[model samples]
Target: MKIPYRGVNAINSREIDKVLILSGTFGEGHQQVANAIHEATQLSLPDVESVVFDFMALGYSYLYPLSQYVYMKGIKKFPRLYGYFFQKTRKVNSFSIKLNAVLSPGMGRTLKLIQEVQPSVVVSTFPFAAGVMSKLKQYGLINIPTVTIITDYTDHSYWIHPLTDQYIVGSNMVRQALNHQGIDDSKISDTGIPIRPKFFQAHDKIELINKFGLDPDLPTILVMGGGYGIIRDGLTTFRALNALPQSIQLIIVCGHNEKLRHQVTEEFKHSKHRIYLTGYIDYIHELMAISDIMITKPGGITTSEAMAMELPMLLYNPLPGQEQDNAQFLVHAGVAMLAENLTDLKTKLLHLLFDPKLLKKMKENTRLFSKKRSTFDALDVIVQMKRQVSIPNFSVTG
Candidate 1:
């Protein structure tokens, strides 16, 4: 008698197992990074089955409205309250253990995904997911290598849990910051974060422009409000871009901001040059493929993607938290430039566009900062680590 053959993942003995990826929607960076790693790992390690998870979508999905009310109201609207909680938590004795105790109940449903996946290696791009996995370990549910990727350049108190196995950080500075939080150097690697595979491929700009129906010769500037459409002074920025020479085309991506999207379209309907307006688009890789410059709010994932595209950044009105730090790093590293206010932003943009030498240098610097094989390197590490795991002599489960 012959048994049925498994499709792709079949093994004879304890083969390295699957990867369970936990992510969240607090920001696009978390989910984007998680999915990129998952995709990369899936391709690089064929034996490894990777499942991407949205932790907040578990029980919090039921209480999503209330959860959003608290998160948005606490962090975005009235951040002082959130800061108070953050500060108080930082001072707590054994904050990780205490936090695990308090949040474990709510995180029970998240562990259910892990139970279902039964992964040998679990990776999380969201900070809170690390806490949830840590809690699950205490409940004797997880025993695999649990890794966390810090999506931001700066480390936060929320990412300081001691139970986390390894950290794929964006910079050496972030690794040092983790050390300050008592995390060992052995647990951290400066991976510069992860971006989707599409960003790494080179495309002919002229061809891309022609394909998008944009003028091949025009100098293009891409403006983005992140993946959530919060471009604080974005309207004014586009208005300024509209005043530029007809040789310049401004591309505005108002992610999920329908009102802003419609408003920008109406404002630029009869424009002399061209304005590429979009709402919650997934083709940012293509947009970055053709643009000469980017005007954005300095989110880490966006910056990394821009770096991958070799696009120079012109940061505008970054937020007060990690975004501000990200802007500083970009400016300091020579990968991008910054503008203190709207007037300065307009002037800088015009100056940068007119100066070809400066633009070329910025692009070169960004390409250098962006790791050429970032996704592959991250995947290589996961595969090598999994091979070292001593599981019951078993094989991949189809």
Candidate 2:
């Protein structure tokens, strides 16, 4: 199944022109990174035609929704259980090996997609996709250059595979962790997590504040859940913050969770301070621009966006696995703080909001830490890999 070339003249002239981005939807981070990379490739490398495929939807259509439900239920109701499983599989073990083996049957559809796309380079933003691509390459079924973008701040054995040609990591710490896991230093590039270009662009703070109907003089706190608005105890957190002595403004962006949005609106309708509630907004960059600090869960893409905005984060009740790791990294970096419960959240938020100097220092740390052009940097790595590699005719087998 050879895919016919359907790109521009410049693309047709080059040996490498198409990019296949494989992503999954267990969390929004994977899909967001896939979209960021696709946008970046289109903007910077005009000749490259990037295609994003939802690997789970394509490969396991029957189980995708069920798997998502289980994942969400686990995170929301059984975080400790999720954490236990996460820790158990943190290192390569028999359980992890068996899990990968069980998932291998689904890779047939992925292999078929590869046959149809005929891409010059394959990139995976999801661990499952990476594992499948690694297995395919290991079996000599695919000869395309394969890159895995680690979307989290930590390293896990599930992300490490034998046949991946390169790795794009979020930070030096993640790269170091990967090194300790035996991945070659040269294969890992600390390009940061890829974020949309809009986040990289400068916007006027006052202008954005005015645009959002926010008072420029008042210190604003931005609250967020990931794309699904799965912030644990979000209403309680808000209630506690509203009880604070300071006259602060709050802007909560509840992403695609109408129930959460309605609950928050009803809960804060008569609050003393100015509270802005919105659902699934596309202008997070604008909201981040006007806020003094963020109270949110520490998902990789969201945290990366906050860091890029140089907005100090109060990681409120991060979940057990990657979110916990992200919180630890940010706290250690001094650009963020962690609040495990309601009492701690109130205490930390008050101290940080009242102390202007501390906020400035955190902002400076964020400025030093952010990788503003990581999207472009990741694209550059892909283009370079494409230029250096020669596509080979390979055979597929079960």
lDDT against the true structure, each candidate = 0.74, 0.85
Cα lDDT of candidate 1 equals 0.74
lDDT of 2 at 226: 93
lDDT of 1 by residue, 168-282 (tens): 8887778887888788898887878887888888788777788888987788889997877777665676777777764678788998778878888877888886778888877
Give per-model TM-scores.
0.87, 0.94
User: Candidate 2: where are CA atoms >4 Å away?
Assistant: 1-16, 103-105, 394-398
Clashes of each: 6, 0
Error of 1 at 371 (Å): 0.8
What is the overall TM-score of model 2 with all chains considered together? 0.94
Candidate 2 lDDT tens digits, 220-305? 99999898898898678778988988888999888878988898888888888898888877789889988999999999999999
lDDT of 2 at 145: 86
- lDDT value, residue 382 of candidate 1: 60
Q: Over 4 Å off in model 1, which ranges?
A: 1-16, 69-105, 245-247, 387-389, 392-398
The best candidate in terms of TM-score:
2
